[model samples]
Target: MNEAIALMKRHRSIRRYKSEAIPLEHVRLAVEAGQAASTSSAIQSYCVIHVTDGLKRKKLAELTGPQEQVRRAGAFFVVCGDTRRHRLLCAREGRAYEARMEAFLLAVIDATLFAQNMALALESQGYGVCYIGGLRSQLFEVERVLTPPEGVYPLFGMCAGVADESPMERPRLGAEAVLFENKYPDDESMLGMIEAYDERYARYIERREGAGRGWSGSMTKKFAEARRVDVGEYYRSKGADFS
Candidate 1:
């Protein structure tokens, strides 16, 4: 295998970390690596804010709910999908700024790519990392704390530091389940594979994370809730005018 693929295969969602400070040079280099990721149409519509203040980090921990990793990690970053700056640029150039769903999606895609690239870069350098999706749970609180403009909002938060524990590689469904030649696989075949994966993943979680819930079980429990907790209105409030 090529060195890059081998490095990628070693990825783990690290939560626990050593309590040492990360060097400023390493943090700066990681951000540079994030910028190296592919961007949609060269728009590069993303921004990353490193959270260094102890009080702010603690508040962020509250915003994230039970994910204490944000408060404990050596470094934390708030990655954002940003189009406000681009809109200002357009205004300065006497052009109309695009503010549709397509534009919003592109910015969010760029932000995710940047964040994943940063994770890969940090992992390659022996740093452990964990992504905090809980930041979206209380979008308005996050918005208030970050003070993002009308066209910008926090996508997710990330924490990185030296490893305190080694996690096992999780299992994935084989190519038969996910990969297809030309057309999508038959429904029966897909369902069978997914069912098999659920059982396997359940065992994996029980063995690894001590969580008995498997993939489908875990997913079902989350989705079976009668009410949805997503912040669609909040996104709309952030100037997203979707079709």
Candidate 2:
């Protein structure tokens, strides 16, 4: 495999981090990498808030289910989908800013791509990063804390630092399962592939001796219980039509 492909394949989310501070140059490079990602219409509808305040980080950690990784990481960033900039531009040009569902979706995708680029850059620089999906747990509170102006919404948080320990590679779906041909395939074959994947994942977890829970069982339990509730209201408040 090529060097870049090898790096991409080996990429993993790192939670535990050493106490050392990340270099300033590396941080700048990571931000540059984020900016270098492709954007829709050259609008650059995204913003990255480089968070350094300890108190704010702790508060964000609390909002994100008190995840220790958020607090322990040397740096934290809140990536946002920012339509406010274009909205302002539209106002200056005497045009209406269409802040619709499709627009928001595009902005969210742009922000995610930027975040992934930054993650890859950090990894290349020997820094570890873990995305905080739980940042959406208390979305409204997070927005309030981050204080992004109207038309900007938080997509996710990323924590980065020198890793204290390595993590085991997580399993991914086989190419046969995910990569379909020109058209959609039959469900029976897909279901069979999924079953095989679940068994493979279960065996891998068992070998690690860590939780030992199968993928199907764990996923079923997670969805069946359904603890997440605040996200809906939060999205609605942000003027997103969730209906």
Q: Quote the RMSD, in angstroms, for model 2.
A: 1.8
Between which residue pairs do clashes occur in model 1?
Answer: none
After superposing candidate 1 on the true structure, give the runs of residues whose Cα lies further than 4 Å from its correct spot: 209-211, 226-230
Q: Judged by lDDT against the true structure, how good is candidate 2?
A: 0.85
Query: Clashing residue pairs in candidate 2, if any?
Result: none
Model 1 Cα lDDT, one tens digit per residue, 1-243: 998999899888899989987899998888889999999889999999899989888888998886788999989999988998888998999998766889889988999999999988888888999999888888888777788888887888999999899988888887788778899988888888989888888888889768767687777888888432657788889888687
Name the 10 consecutive residues with the lowest summed lDDT in model 2. 234-243
On lDDT, the candidate that comes out on top is 1
Write the residue-wise lDDT of candidate 2 on 86-171 in tens digits.
88899999998766777888888999989999999999998899999889888878887888777778888999999988878889
Each model's lDDT comes to: 0.87, 0.85
